[model samples]
Target: MEAILRIYTHYFIYYDIEMTQYANEIKISADNPKIGHVHKPNSEATLMGVNVNINSDGLRDKEYPVERGQKYRIIFLGDSITFGWGVEKEDTFETLLEVKLNEIKPTEVLNFGTGNYNSEQEVNLFFKKGQKYKPAHIVLFYFINDAEITPQKSKWEFLSHSRVITFFWSRIQGLMANLSESKSFKSYYSGLYSDDQQGWINTKKALTQMAQYSRANQIRFDVILLPELHNLNDYPLKAEHAKIITFLNENNINGIDLVPFFSSVEDPQELWVAADDAHPNKKAHQMIADFSFDFITRGIKWEKN
Candidate 1:
């Protein structure tokens, strides 16, 4: 009897272990580049190093290893939104841009965009690691969302306690268990409640300081401002961009402003953005890619190529 009880207890223990939840990073694959993921060399510190695929994909779980003597490298730097949230790896703007470039030019572009990264960290990434790559063009993708203070409030919590976001998402799943038939309700509630994206004001010079560094090194710099799904003229963010743009101009840094593009969005809901999440889908990425390719290859004259 005693032996049987002990065996049952051990079985329960093993069963519980199998039910454990996994961290978000665990879902990424090091070999597959088509899933459209972003990875960090290390994520414990404030300043993190990220490896994204500019050619294979906009974001990649695997690292984009640079050849020792490869010439003409382009580095894409940005946060999670720039990292392509729910989209697959091969469909990102950076990857599309690289394909377009390959059709016209003959060079490799490396993307280093990571999730939950701010411009301050991006500057660090370029100064610390990008030089090793000897990139010809340093394209920094700055989202209006970066102005928020706590970008990874949920993911950071998941690092310590996966149950935090897990439970919340679970409850949402339960609430929508029966309402799955309704797309609008599913989208609205999912967007509103899943993540606590309360945007907060932070210091604005993060990008300006970055601009100064890239400029001093005589590298071609372009700041692409990725607009959120929300309206462009809205408070907090629109005003936020004003401050960043002013700083860029004050320092004479070239940048792409997308406020005009936001006003032109016809049916905003068509941009479901991966189940009402901030990450836009393939269509949005294509639009951004078209805009970027024209701006980079045509609008700006690069002395490197």
Candidate 2:
């Protein structure tokens, strides 16, 4: 009876912990009208054996000076993946890249990633807060789902306490969404890029805004396209990639597609945060950092001090 009880306790704890932590750490930001939410300032959360600490400025990284002081600062904007998700802060690509770039010259990479952010929200956040850092460069990690509309804060706050309940609820919601739209995941993602889709339209508008701002301000800007992790060997989202690249080219924005980087992985699942979470693991982050390091060093024309 004791052994059986311990097994049950472990099972319950494993399922419920992450949900509770996420709820405690994230808050709806009334000030963030465009992004809709932000991390709780100076708070900490542990999810899937990883610690996420938000600074006083409500950013995931260490506190940085508001003023750029002779250091070449690079600002990274995106959703959760860029936020490091389930990965450690030191192992994240942003941190790794910062270290690598600083080897060549004084550099700082500011991570402005927020979970569940669409393209519009990311750009909005940058204009609202990120520009204060006066970064020399900007890198937007564009995930495939970033074209989707900004997700509203969940109304079922009470259910967040129980991962079991949240799991079933999400499953039911997906079922309803499928029933309503009758579209598979691939079809749904493809539909987001359709000419009439407001999400895609707004994404383009936001990208254009960022690109123009970068050009006008003499700030180097690049968009690194992040691939969907389910299947990397034969990525099925090539069409979406082409569409984004074409738009970037037309707008004179530098774009880097990262899909090919992970294609060599025989089993993409090995790079996942967990069996359930599709966010990249440490290995994947290292791969991104290595590739980004090479790209930045090769492409960026270093300004002599």
lDDT per prediction? 0.56, 0.82
- Please name the candidate that would achieve the greatest lDDT relative to the true structure: 2
Which pairs clash in model 1?
Answer: 34-89, 35-89, 36-89, 52-111, 54-111
**106-145 in candidate 2: lDDT tens per residue?**
8888898887788899999899878888888888999998
TM-score, per-candidate, Cα-based: 0.64, 0.88
Candidate 1 displacement at residue 68 in angstroms: 6.1
* TM-score (C-alpha, index-matched) for candidate 2: 0.88
Model 1, span 69-123: residue lDDT tens: 4445688888655665545657778778887886755656676776656665566
Q: Model 2: how large is the Cα RMSD against the reference?
A: 3.6
List candidate 2 stretches off by more than 4 Å: 1-20, 154-164, 173-183, 303-305
